[model samples]
Target: MNAWIGTLIALCALALSAATAYVQHRARKRETLGADVTAYFHRTSDFARIKLFDGTVRQAGYHLVIWNHGPAPAERVHLAVADVEGAAVELADCPPDEFPLQRLDKGARYPVPWIPVSDTHRGARRFTVHLRWQDGNGTQERLLPMRRGQTNV
Candidate 1:
């Protein structure tokens, strides 16, 4: 009976060891080979002319920017917006060749020339920017909480 008990305990210890090793390996792999991209709403003072949906150019100082903060490069970057606490928003009037970016290297920043459009969006906006990209490991994604008219989204 004592021998059986000892065998059971040994088995549990071995299983735990294997599980820990597996977790560590996965973490290392992702850290070294995965792409971590982030998107945020940026507030600027340029007040650049941005064309509205109705072909009317307006001066706005807010925009979106994408950055890859990982060791690996990101490919096929895509963006999606979701309203977390306030009105939903959609990007409109983007340049023709600026979207669906093909590649972005690590530590690189890309200006996302997009304007937010919504019928009922006003006053203290809360949203989420979904960034999806492909790396050596697989397709990785991240969600960034954002607020309008702020640079630290």
Candidate 2:
């Protein structure tokens, strides 16, 4: 009788250990899924005709673009741009102060409006792009610095 009771207690302890390990595994999986939604923005340029006080001028303007590289989709996305040096910058064509991107799917790219740098901002070489979005887990925010020659996505 003593041996049977000891065996039963040992079995219960083993079962409890297995159950605890399974719960921990599931928690780790959930954390991994939440961390999978990584995204970033990059700098790109294109030429277009923009209107000025004098007339229309064809010029190359830079655009800040965000590309979703993760497997999950980003929702309720927003973006803002600012010069890294805190210098005054002018945009030939201004984008909205805040973007209301409803959804950005995986492998998708979203470009802000083209901003032609004026002579005053010529010395600025780096800019910060602030991005916020929601994934399957919750909301996330990132501030990325983009340089003239470097790109991140």
Q: Cα lDDT of model 2 overall?
A: 0.63
- List per-prediction Cα lDDT, in the order shown: 0.76, 0.63
lDDT string, candidate 2, 1-153, tens digits: 999999999999999999999999987766645423333434344454466545656443445567877667888887666686655455555545445578888778865434445664544567666678888768888877767553221
Question: What's the lDDT for residue 147 in model 1?
Answer: 74
Deviation in Å, model 2, residue 94 alpha carbon: 4.7
Model 2 segments beyond 4 Å from truth?
1-58, 86-94, 113-119, 150-153
TM-scores for all candidates? 0.67, 0.61
Give the Cα error of residue 37 in candidate 2, in Å: 6.9
Best by TM-score: 1
Candidate 1 error regions (>4 Å): 1-29, 51-55, 85-88, 95-98, 122-124, 150-153
